[model samples]
Target: MIQQPFFTPAILLVLFAIPLALGWVPRNRFYGIRTRRALADDAAWYRINRSGAWCLIVSGLFYLAVAWVVPMSGPQDVNFRLWLLHLFAFVLPLLLGLVRIRHLSRQD
Candidate 1:
């Protein structure tokens, strides 16, 4: 049987974000938050992506925390909801990053 899938993805998310957060991931269309303004401008790329990466890192940690806190092994629906919660937590950073970019862009 597959063990604790939640930890795997959460760990991966944190692992992926740490590099980008550290400005290691070069701005590219294939990875990182590829906003037009961010991709076009060097300064914005680091600022925007770094901000997004931080969000992703936090999201990943939050998911880990929830998964650790909730010892739910009951109904399948509950498990499904937990997954839905994780999905929501995962995607929220993307939406937040977009909004944050708008504000951060103005600051520059």
Candidate 2:
């Protein structure tokens, strides 16, 4: 695990803001790709996707926190496993974003 004494709390706080970050930032802007179609549809899609992304980020951080805080009397390997689990949380949202993009492209 990436061990940073101060990083944990800072990362956690930032992770918490992930939801609000996605919410406040426009979808088209956040997604890093622009669409050439109805404004409402794109906006709606962006909002939903952003929400999902935030959720993933936040969840991943939570897992990271747990792995650090919980002192399970297990082998050293468990720490690495926990970190990997944390990564998955963040990755899942990006995958969802890809799906969302495909869905949008399918539209007329």
Candidate 3:
């Protein structure tokens, strides 16, 4: 019997977690180095706030959708559901991010 690679979904899930965990910390501690040059001093906090919220929303949706989609090893095909989830996951957050970025930009 061929040994199959273990499909630990948690490992995949952690890919989603690590970034948000780091992002939740003090801005200068986790993301400060990246922002030190590009973001205006005033915009830095706004940028972090907006991005962290976006990440939380996106990652939560992604993990939930993946959990729903990955366990369809039955007679029914779930490709359409997966596709729909992917579409929403891709588009909604992008639209929200754009709107939030515009709002944040206008603040400064």
Candidate 4:
């Protein structure tokens, strides 16, 4: 088993999202999705953030799983395939969250 430092950010994202996902974190400038669509109104803020939170959590878990399953001695050992998987784990959620936000924004 190899320890992947890149995966640490994914885990951190999951941790960071817990509060926002649960609504413990309010809409503010420092955290959560501060997009124009997400911050347009209270409802949009909660809805978008909630969806974003789920995306983050799911992606984070996927990243952790991949990181665990993939064999690598260190950062330098990461190959193109592993890099793509890691990128997908991080970017997929972001794209999905943006879509969700757009969808929610349209509702308003």
TM-score of each: 0.69, 0.38, 0.39, 0.76
Candidate 4 lDDT score relative to the true structure: 0.74
Q: What is the lDDT of residue 81 in candidate 4?
A: 81
Q: lDDT, candidate 1, residue 99?
A: 75
lDDT on C-alpha atoms for all candidate structures: 0.71, 0.50, 0.46, 0.74
In the range 13-54, model 1's lDDT, one tens digit per residue, is: 789889889998887998887777878888888988798788
Worst 10 residues of 2 by lDDT: 30-39
- Candidate 4 per-residue lDDT over residues 1-108, each given as its tens digit: 336755668778889988888888777889997888666677778887887788778878776777677645676765878777767766786677668766766775
Instruction: Give the runs in model 2 whose Cα sits over 4 Å from its true position.
Output: 1-22, 29-40, 71-108
Candidate 2 Cα deviation (angstroms), residue 42? 3.7
Candidate 1 TM-score versus the reference: 0.69
Candidate with the larger TM-score of 1 and 3 = 1
- The superposed Cα distance between candidate 1 and the true structure at residue 98, in angstroms, equals 5.7
**Highest lDDT among the candidates is held by which one?**
4
Position 30, candidate 2: lDDT: 41
Better of 2 and 4 by TM-score: 4
